[model samples]
Target chain A: MCGIVGLLVKTPALKARLGELMVPMLIGMTERGPDSAGLAVFTEPLATDERKISLYSGLTEEGADFNWLGLGHELKAHLGIEARMAVQGNHAVLTIGIAPEPVKRWIKEHHPRLHILSTGRAIDLYKDIGTPTEVAERYDFKHLTGTHLVGHTRMATESAVTPDRAHPFTAGEDFCLVHNGSLSNPYGVRRMLEPRGIKFETDNDTEAACRFLEWRLREGDDLETALQKGFAELDGFYTFLMGTTDKLALIRDPFACKPAVVAENDEYVAIASEFRSLAHLPDIKNAKVFEPAPEEMYVWTA
Target chain B: MDSLKFDLAEIPLRTVNTFLHQEAPGQGVRKVLITNPDGAHNIAVGLDFPVEIEIVGHAGYYAGGMNKQASITVTGSAGTGVAENMMSGRVHVKGFASNGAGASAHGGLLVIEGDAGLRCGISLKGGDIVVGGSVGSFSAFMAQAGRMVICGDAGDALGDSLYEAVLYVKGSIKSLGADARIEPMAEADLATVKALLAAAGPAFDQYAPQDFKRVASARSLYHWNADANQEY
Candidate 1:
């Protein structure tokens, strides 16, 4: 079992409070998944020519102090460009005024152990092996601001309770996904994507789904069309909450064995695995709360 | 009736559920009022006595599952499996409900004032479910017995693999399942529909028994044939 929560603000006035609003929603799901937690915040976009890359160094060697600041300076020297790095526990968000491909290649060649979480103009991802509150505090989550956010608290069912195995798996540029239930055919799906040259970082089923979605989008299928095709290809009991650069989408399997609830109003669109995660939202009593129909994809765009 | 109150926000869900489990059927307390439920799951489960429970706010999954001889009311919407596997008594939802509203229930009455999600009354053994609004697809899949009444439209593939259960739909049916077909209502069916509608409350008083279409199993596929086995 896992807990998934997402929020998309319609009113720009509430943008600054996005992290504050999401913290409680994430913590409320601590019971669902106490082993690990993660969140992805889509903040204001960078300059059109700039890019941001979020990376994680999962569990450094014991007694070895990983020098994140020194790595930033080395990256600057290696790429011959200025890079600003913000370290949050083992995760780091590096903003560079350069293209992404060359930076990614540099990291791949120099720091082969670092795991790239996501790369985009607006997205900054953070995750760790701890309680939701602990992870949030490690990242100073409540102070972060964004226009929208998606998070997950994961219990180890198929994979180890490592930071990289935590949820909010990202594959496509600025795209991430969190799943609530297990997948029955992830190995088959991985076999399919592997032949197409899609690299996988984790054996987690949600990562397979993320990579599949990235491949679908690469094939020119829109979010709704990709999800509709997912229903036909992916076989399992699942509730998926996915986000793109500008949109948030939700879909449940045909059986809908997993639970999900959506609450929307003029100010925001909020989704959680249960109503308790949403009860504390602003004006929740007045919001239109409903369970999404099975196999039907619902999306909200910024 | 002697009434007891629980504010879920102040008390843990385990505490309230434990209190209900220990309370005797004919004991001093005859009614329970749970305020600020806020959609906590598995509330008031496994009750075996005739008591009235009124949840003042939204409730989560399996609100009254495996109940017996009790009357439960949710003033707001209910989550999935609201009255699953109930043996007796009545469960009423003032607002909408999620999937499997009365799943695998044996004997009871479940009334939903608003729309119900997918697979409402799935695998129903003997319970009677009445929905005031529309129900999603596969409303009564593999139902063995009892009756289901829907005042609004039904989504795609209603009553798939249905058995002896009787379904009465007042609105349009998107499609019927395999071995399921519409049949004419008998006099006894008309009486049953009217009684169920009346039990649903005054809002359903305007629906005449004649406006509904009855659906039942064909009974021809009870035994498997080699030719039909290809379809499986």
Candidate 2:
């Protein structure tokens, strides 16, 4: 079983402590998932023309000493675009002025081993192969400031424990999903999406679901409509938690084979696979704690 | 007898459970107060005594599992399998409960003051369950013997394949499983609901025994028909 946690702060003041508040929530699920940990946080958006790409150099040869500024300069020279990067250990968030397709392709061409974690105006993602505590310390998750975040701890069942295979899987941009239950027909869903030109990143089942839902959203289906289709086509036991630019959405399969508990107050809305992960939240005693029903869509806006 | 206190914030749950298992009885303790449970799993499990355990906060998985004579009470919500596989005693939750709330119990009274998630009393050998609120899908599947009193609605597939176990539901039932049918409630069913509701608590007293409907199995799957070509 994997662990999924999400926190959406309604009060603007609580946004400053988003990541700090989520650290305990993520670490609390250590018993459920102990292999790898990851999170996607939606921060203040950048300019309309600028898109930030979160890159992980953990698998690179140089590892922690990977040259992020050097890549920025190379991008400036090759693509004639000013790229500003915030270097953090093996992870970096690089902001580029031009469109992201060429820059992403260039990065893939030059640094094939470097994994692109996410790309969007509001999202900066970090995921790695380690325990939740180690991963949180490595990325300094406590210092991150955002309106909302989705975190995951992995207990590998259907796939290997690679950083790219870790959760908060992204599809187009600003859209991420974490799954708890296993999908019975991921390959069938893959065949359905591959013919439509959706290239998969990993053989993991959760990625297939993530891409399918995001592709539906990109195909002009509203969130609710796309999720209705997801309920129809995606055949498996899943409690999916998705995060977009301004919304956090959740849905369970028809059977709700997986577990999920939600706690909401005037200040924040927190979700976890179990109540243990959310026990440490402030004022949680007064929160409206409840379990989400099967085949029901729950959405919260920032 | 003096009541003992165990603060989970400062002490590990093992110490409390060990005390309950090893020394609480010898010390003449009849009551236990557990504070800051914080949804920790296995708060007071495997008790063979008649001591009363009061958990001040939420409890995690299997809070009162395998109980013999102990009476456990949680002031807040309980996680999955709160009183699963209980032999005898009483488990009470003041708030809602997660999946498989009272699964496969042999004997005891499991009370959820609020709702209970999917498969509330699956595979029950013999036990009594009183749900003050709704119960999710697949409640009381494949029960050998026991009874359940549901004050609120029930989700899909209530009592799929049952044996001698009866369910009294006051609210609507979404669907009934195969071989399960709604029959007229006799005087015995009403009396059972009355006794179970009174045992549940005063809050459940508002629900009258006559308001409930009885659901039981048709016993069609008791004997197989080989000549029918494997169709139900």
Candidate 3:
């Protein structure tokens, strides 16, 4: 079991206050999930010549003050590309004036202990094992500014309670997902994706779903088509909230076992496992609140 | 009569549910008014005593689930699995309900004033369900015993693989399940419908007892045969 909250700000004026509005939404679901929490925020895109890679370093013995500056120097030497780095909590965002693919390969070979949580022009991912409130504060979520965000609080029903096992699992560039229910045939899906060169960091079912969507997008299917195919291929009860650079998409399984409520206003579109998480939003009384039907996909774009 | 009012905006749902769970019957409080529910799941589950719980706004999944003797009422729409596995007492929803309402309930009365979503009475044992509006597809599937009355149209595959239970629909049925078929209404059937309508309150006053059509199991597939297995 887990709780998922997503917000897509339609009004550009409210973009900078995304994190302030999202804090309560994430904390409201603390009772549903208390093990760990993760969030993915999409802010302004990087310059066309640059890319950003968010990496988690808690696994290192150095803890939160790990040598990110030294790592940046090493990357510059190893790849012969200039890079800048900023450390927040246990995560470090590295912006490099180079393509992302080779940089990702360099990191995989050099720093196997570091986990690349996200890599995109706009997305920054942070996750840790703590209460939603604690994790949100630790990452300075209230001060973070973004156009859209996806967050999750996990209960650890199927996987160990570790940072990597936490949700908002990233797929393609600037694409991430948070799931509420367990998948039945994740191992089978993993086996299918492994041979296609899709790497997995954890044995969690949501990772398999994330990788599947990435593979589908790689195969030239749009997000809507991939989700429609997922309903036929994936066997489980799930409510998935997926995020991309421009869109926030939601879909539920045919049975619709998990609870989900969506509220939309002229300012923003919000989704959560329950309405209580959304009740405190601005102009909520005027927002349209409705439960998304089974096998239906709803999308909000920025 | 003593009544207590709780505003969910001022308190957490867990705290309110804990208080409701600890309260004993006939101790003093006979009614509870919960305001600003705002679609929180599992509002009043496992309630065994005879008390009245009136929720002022929309409720989330599993509202009043596993109810025994409590009479719970929702002023707005209810999420999935309302009154699920209920053993006794009553649950009333003033607005629409999501899927699996009253699923696997053994005994009780669940009344929905508006439309019910898919699989409304799946695996019902003995509970009596009344829907004022249309019910979605695959309702009453694998129902062992119970009674379901739908005042509006019924969606596809109504009463699939049903046994012993009786279904009464005042409007059209999209289709019947494999082992279920329509039956002739008798004097006792009219009496049953009339009593169920009365129990549902005055909203159903215009529905005459004769308006319902009875549906039951065909009994042809009771014992599985090698040839019959091919059809499945």
Error of 3 at B211 (Å): 7.3
The full ranking of all candidates by DockQ, starting with the best, is 2, 1, 3
Q: A1-302 in candidate 1: lDDT tens per residue? A: 88999999977677888888999999989988898999889987899888899988765551125577888789778778788888766778889998898999888887787878889998899888899999999888888788888999998798888888998899867889999999999999999999898988888888888889889988999888899889988888789998888889999988787889999999999999988889888888889988888888899997
- Compared with the true structure, all predictions reach lDDT values of 0.89, 0.92, 0.89
Give fnat for candidates 1, 2 and onward, in order: 0.58, 0.58, 0.47
lDDT of 3 by residue, B90-109 (tens): 99999888889999999999
List the candidate numbers ranked by TM-score, top first: 2, 1, 3
- lDDT string for model 2 (A1-302, tens) is 98999999988778999988999999998778899999999998999999999999999999999988888888889998898889899999999888899999999999999999999999999998889999999999998889999999989899999899998899899999999989999999999999999999899999989999999999999999999999988988899999999999999998879989999999999999988899889999999999999999999999
Indicate which candidate wins on lDDT: 2
Winning model by DockQ:
2
- List where candidate 2 sits over 4 angstroms from the true fold: B229-232
TM-score attained by model 3: 0.87
| lDDT for each residue of candidate 2 in B1-232, tens digit (9 for 90 to 100) | 5698889999999989998999887887889999999989998999998899999988999999988899999999999998999999999999999989889999999999999999999998899999999999999999879999999999999999988899999999999998889999999888899999999889887999999999999998888867767753
Candidate 3 lDDT over A1-302, as tens digits, reads 78999999877678988999999999988988898998999988999878889999888777787788888889888889888887885789999898899998888888787889999999999999999999999888887788999999999888899999999899768999999999999999999889988888898999998999878988999989999888887889899999988889999987677778888888999999887788788988678776777788998888
Interface RMSD of 1: 1.1
What fraction of the reference structure's interface contacts does model 2 contain?
A: 0.58
Candidate 3: regions farther than 4 A off: B1-3, B11-31, B40-52, B66-70, B87-89, B114-118, B132-138, B151-157, B169-178, B182-214, B224-232
TM-score of predicted chain B versus true chain B for each candidate: 0.96, 0.97, 0.97
